[model samples]
Target: MDIIVEGIKQAFILLFTLDREVLGITWLSLKISGSATFLSMFIGVSVGTAVALNQFPGRRFVVSLINTGMGLPPVVVGLFVTIFLWRNGPFGFLEMLYTPTAIVIAQTVIATPIVMGISLAAIQSLPANLRLQILALGATRLQMVWILVKEARLPLLAAVMAGFGGVISEVGASMMVGGNIKGYSRVLTTATVMETGKGNFAIAMALSIILLLLAFTVNVVLTQIQQRDRPR
Candidate 1:
């Protein structure tokens, strides 16, 4: 009880003071997760749409793989990514391990499948004859795809929310790949973990509050867009 109250006070203090380190961690968390979500949106929406619209022999298997990937553990992702970026690993020549870029890469991997799976479902939920109707009106294949995407924009936006939520709250992969170095790769999630491990419950809770507030603010904006676009 006291601890929770103290934590709330700490959170308020941190916000009021605009502590440099806390602000930096918060900003880095947003930047990395935002980039990951954006990159995932591009690749995920494209691949998902292509998969949904095409008829290929191995398409189901590919979708199953993606669906499975949507639930992939962040720690496992961290392990493989860490191995890949290790000194002697395949991409070791790039020397990206323990860097902010590495965190982005790991987070992108974590978020992509989630966005892709949701995107696939959103595209598939459209009217079956919609494509035919568009083509019947002399629309090119490219234009048809564009129109279908526009029709499904609302649920696709949900994909954005889910992808951003997943990565922004993720801590294990960020810790594994980013090394949680101060002022470099440290983020709200990892910072909270470190503080908790050090028995600084109030600090940890403050970080958690900040993370929640940040996520809530972004989601509020997205939700407004989503609701505003709702069909009458």
Candidate 2:
């Protein structure tokens, strides 16, 4: 109990003091996760909507695969990403291992399916005749898709939240791909893990607190946008 309280106090101190290391880690975390979520949103929404609207062979199988990917284990993702980025591995000529960019790639892999699955469901949940209605009104297919996406904005926003949440809180993939290099690739989750491993319980707890607060702040802003203009 005392430890927990002390940790909270330390977290505030770190925040109030504008600790450079903590702030840098926090910013990098947001930047990487934000970029990952944005990329996932672009790819996931496009592919998910296409799949939702079209009738094709093996469509069910593809959807099942996407659903499976939503729950893909982070450590497993980390392992494959690490392997692919290894010095002698394919595409290793770019030499991206143990870097922030590598972390972003792993996180993008982690978040894309989550966003894709939710986007697929959101587009599918609309009234069956909605797409036809839009097309019947002289809207082109592209315009119809745009309208449908607009209609599904609320749930799509939720997908953003989920994707960002997943990547921001994950440590395994970041640690594996980033090597948790201080002042470069270090982030709250990896830092917390490192501190705990070194028995710096107070520092670990403080980092954890900061991470939770960061997640909460981002979600709060997103939630506000989501709820705004919602029907009373």
Query: Which tens-of-lDDT digit does each residue in 150-219 have in candidate 1?
Result: 9999989999899999999999999999999999999999999999999888778878988999999999
Q: What's model 2's TM-score?
A: 0.96
Name the regions of candidate 1 deviating beyond 4 angstroms.
229-232
Count of backbone clashes, every candidate in sequence: 0, 0
**lDDT of the candidates, in the order given:** 0.93, 0.92
Point out the worst 10-residue segment of candidate 2 by lDDT: 199-208
Over 84-138, each residue of candidate 2 has an lDDT whose tens digit, in order, gives 9899999688899999999999999999999999999999999999988999999
